[model samples]
Target chain A: MSKVKKNVWWLVFSLLFLLVLTVAISDQYYLLVSFLFLIGTMVPLYSRFEKKKIQSREIVFLAVLGAIAAASRVLFFAIPSVQPMTFVVIVSGMVLGSEGGFMIGATGALVSNMFLGQGPWTPWQMFSWSMIGLIAGLLKDSALLKNMRSRLLFGFVMGFLFGWVINLWSVIAYIHPLSWLAFIQAYIASFYFDLAHALSNVFFLWLFSSSWIKVMRRFQKKYGLLD
Target chain B: MHTVLNDVHPITSFCYYIGVMILSMMFLHPVFLIGELFLFILYNICQHNGAKMKQMFKGAWFFIGVIVIVNPLLNHQGTHHLFYIGRNPITLEAIIYGGLLALSFCCLMFIFLSYNLVITSHKFLYLFSRISPQLALLTMITMRFVPLFIRRLTTIKAIQKTRGIQMDSGNIKTRARNGMHLVQILLVCSLEEALQTADSMEARGYGVKKRSSYLRYHMEKRDIFSLILGAIILGICIYGKLKGFGDLQIYPSLGSFGLKGIEDVMLLILTLLFTGYPLILEGREWLWWRWQK
Candidate 1:
């Protein structure tokens, strides 16, 4: 475990080294921040996986759920941004707790992108989905998440938020100086896609969120997993 | 697997992507960018044939045209004014700038597509597993689970069809409900089976001792040859870049972009050899095939 721990720390430290290397080679701000933000999120998540002491049971559960999440993304391909990937992550958090939720979200994004084609957007997708899982996990104990109305509301809001975060990739890559006008224009244009995504998230949460939670909870109880 | 990239070590492939991406992004000079882009297309064609390369280029020309048409609309700058679009002046600098951007972006896209081809998922996980076996194993299993799950979904759908469950054709709500029901079945069946997987792993002594991956990828002679060749070409390009041979300045003004002399031409030639190394390797194989024939 300690040895495994060291590798994650190396992942964290290597970012600094990589930052120095990127700076020495290129004077571009976009390159610098992308590297920074990517590594910054990656290191913590790797450590979180380590700290959880997640066993084979939890891992298999996570992997299968992640598979379903990715498959669901494909299943809903015709519907345009309406998929249960985010919904699955959110419910995984509510049931399996925070880290488990985060794992499902991150892994779901990673596996889907592996099939879909990995690109600059891959890391950002992982980051966005992981955050949604993490946030949901943190709120699992609260009344807000426990209540169905608030959960649906949260899902709707998160739908829009996820799209906004994803929109950052285009801004980071193309639009230099990050002008407010240009940024707003891009955001405004993507509003419909974001709306569709958010609405779909709400739909999933409203419809199947409770049932998924029940199934996972029952499975975890039966196997004594994710404790 | 037949591609030249399939033969190179993952480390080498990783370096190639990073190098090409950084270069494609950093080198704004049309000479360097054009040469890079040309070799990228040539290499892509050689590796994936015209079909895959053309698939990549689908709508690419349209994108370049968009950049050429749209950049000047948004940005009104530079002394070399070309024409006007409504209220804005479309300057020569803006057009040139947009063209450079379009070219470099195409090169970048090629680099990414090549990466997708070269560093397949198992290789990527293999690289990561060297660092953290636990997380990498989880990710590898998750990646495996996707295709496996998809296959299972189709099987279940087929089984459901026998039972009068029509998922393939229905109203939107009905179709969506069937999808959810199919997913629910997947959840229950997979989770139930996951217990067996965990038991098997535990039986195999997983998580008890430090795990080590057994895949053996060594630096063969060709790997070493390509590595050194790659390093030398990369060194020269970076040195040239450092020496300001590949600079393409834009903004308040566009700077002179001329080849200084023989060194510049030789440098460009070196870059061609460097960028086109994949094509060289693939062509060598092609020649060997011809000789065999």
Candidate 2:
């Protein structure tokens, strides 16, 4: 409990610091600020995982979900920007809770990139997917994510959010002067890809997430995994 | 795969790629970037043949094109205006900035391509394992499960198709539904088995003590030598960066393209050598092989 409190305090402090940092920094430093932002946000989650005494069962369970998510990515490789990875991650989160969900999401990104080829985008991909899982798990019991329709809505939003986060790298790296016009233009250029991703997430969640969640929940209960 | 960096220690190569990546981002100068890009492209050509390089270009040209074309249109901050579509002036500085950034990104992409070829999955895992043993173990398990799940998915797809649950032969929504259903079945079946694998692992005493790696990587004499050279080169580059020697100032006004002093020339040469670290090793190996014969 104290550890959780400490983490929350750290989070609040970092959020405040980041807000100030972004407002204070110059435009040319956008790339450096964004990187620092990524590292700052990611460190806490990974450190929490490191501090815990993880079990073999939990490790294997997360690995299996990650592998399944990555396999779906590879299977749907022919389709551009359309995969059920987010759907799988959402279901994993809904079943396994936030920590498990974050691991699976991150692991899924890492493993999939192994088969697909790693690039500068790998870290961004990991960050986006992991956030999706973390948010889903956090909201699993909330009224916002209770029903299938609302869950689908969440997935849809997350899909675009994921694309936008990935687009941040390019915008930061390439956009000169870093004006709002340039930022908006970059986002606008990638609009179609984000739309496709969002629609696919909605489709997968609407048609299949409930069943995936049910199966996962059953496994969790039967094996007492992640308890 | 007898690639150039194939035998180099993962630590050495990883540091080299990371150093070059950081330096490329910092050195916005055209001379620095063009020389760096040229060396990496040459290294990439050495790593793969002409046909593969063409395929890489095909994959990368879209992003490069977008950056080159979009920057000048949106950014009107520079002094020298090239032209204007309407109200927005296409300044020479924005165009030059865009081109340099595109070149930098293209170089990084080629470097990553070489990274993919050389580091491979196991080496990456090995590097991570040193930092966090548990995370490394989890990644290894995840890596192991990927191919297994892929095979299982293929089998499940075959069985599902036999039962008329075809994923590829339907409309978009229907196909997507069928696909998720297949994955759901996979999840249900695999979860139980994965737990059993966990149980077997427990039986074999997995979490008892420190886990050992299956494949060992050594930091050999050459790797050490390379590390020493890398440290010196990158130290100089970083020092040069702090002194604002390699970077060009483009905003407000354009900076001159010529070297300011002897320090600038030396820094430029060091930056190129640092970026060409992989090629240096490859060339040495090529010469050694030929000379021995």
How do the residues B130-154 of candidate 1 rate in per-residue lDDT, one tens digit apiece?
7776678788888888878888989
At residue B120, give the lDDT of candidate 2.
Answer: 86
lDDT of 2 by residue, B1-293 (tens): 36768787889888988888888887878888889888877887787645766888898899899899988887788899888888888898888889989988988887787788888898898888877777878888888888888888889999999899978787877887787788888888898899998999999998898766576777799989989988998898888888878767788877787777888789889888888887888888889999999
Largest lDDT belongs to which candidate?
2
- Which residue pairs collide in model 2, if any? none
Model 1: which residue pairs collide? none
Q: Could you tell me which 10 consecutive residues in candidate 1 chain B have the lowest summed lDDT?
A: B62-71
Top TM-score: which candidate number? 2
Error of 2 at B11 (Å): 0.7
